[model samples]
Target: MRNVSRCGVVMLSVILSAGLASPAAAKEPSSEPEHVGVLDAAVESLTGDVYAEPSRWRPLSLGTLFTEGWDQAWASPTRGSGGAPRQGWIGAANGVFYRLGLAAYSYAHDVGDNGDEHAGTLTLYTPFSRRFELRHDIPFVVNNKGSGNSYHTNVGDFSIAPRVILSESQDFTQSFG
Candidate 1:
């Protein structure tokens, strides 16, 4: 579990920094403006004990990952990249439950290309009650340079996720991602 989280952090760093190669903005004598950091939130649940001890838990999770690059850009020679903080989140709900959310925040300087990056997403799911299930997630990205920084973003891929029940126990659940 520790290794997986570390890998996720590394991958996110690479993606955010790739944007740092662009031209730097003209130097301004005034104080640099500050922008608000991104915030992400999410919620979820499993049929049985997804993270339960006896059953060993697993589930196919689908959600947007956020990245930020601001803290890194400031040290650049050309202001080649610099921005504000960033964040992200993932969550789900069904007829049985409501308002469940799960979320994560970007590290201070994880923004990839030398600019601060921020993002958020919303999703809608249908019970499909039984075993098979379907879900859709709409994701958004926001990268800010500062108070008046330029913006770069995308709605991200519209994907279809199909979930199957592999195993379920009274206190645990196991599924594949």
Candidate 2:
């Protein structure tokens, strides 16, 4: 996360310096602007207009946060790339993601062992990137067979899988990892 912020700052600075380093305007008599750092509000004014009109396929109330958000979700071949509205469900190529859900878990044992167990469970999916998704499950424990503080909890082991998009088509998509 710290790396992401540092990279963003560097990128933004490069864009601002390049965009604002151009020659001054000839007709600049708009009542001396206030000083804001080095270039007043001039730099801000120029950068604010970077985005064009929203694509017809999708409109955004806000920018996609860390490249994780919804897209048009339709597999179309006509859409372009880069700041253009997506035309398919392949929304993000590389970014962190999280999914929270629930499940019903069941278990049974022999006559000499524990009888049976049925409980709700919480499933959390944490992705380091689009290529690798990790899942941790927490079961609702009615009992823990007299274990310690940590073992007495309802926590379960994690299941991790590295994923990749194997193929994409106008009709469908495939992934493997």
* TM values, all candidates: 0.34, 0.29
What's the CA error at residue 114 for candidate 2, in Å? Answer: 4.1
TM-score of 1: 0.34
* Candidate 1, superposed: residue stretches over 4 Å from native: 1-113, 144-150
Candidate 1, poorest ten consecutive residues by summed lDDT: 71-80
Please, what are the lDDT tens digits per residue for candidate 1 over residues 20-120? 53333333223321222211111112222222231121121222111221111111011112432111133422212111233333333545555666666
lDDT score of residue 156 within candidate 1:
57
Give the range of the ten consecutive residues with the poorest summed lDDT in model 2.
69-78
In the order shown, what is each candidate's alpha-carbon RMSD?
Answer: 27.0, 20.1
Model 2: clashing residue pairs? Answer: none
Model 2 lDDT, residue 40, Cα: 23
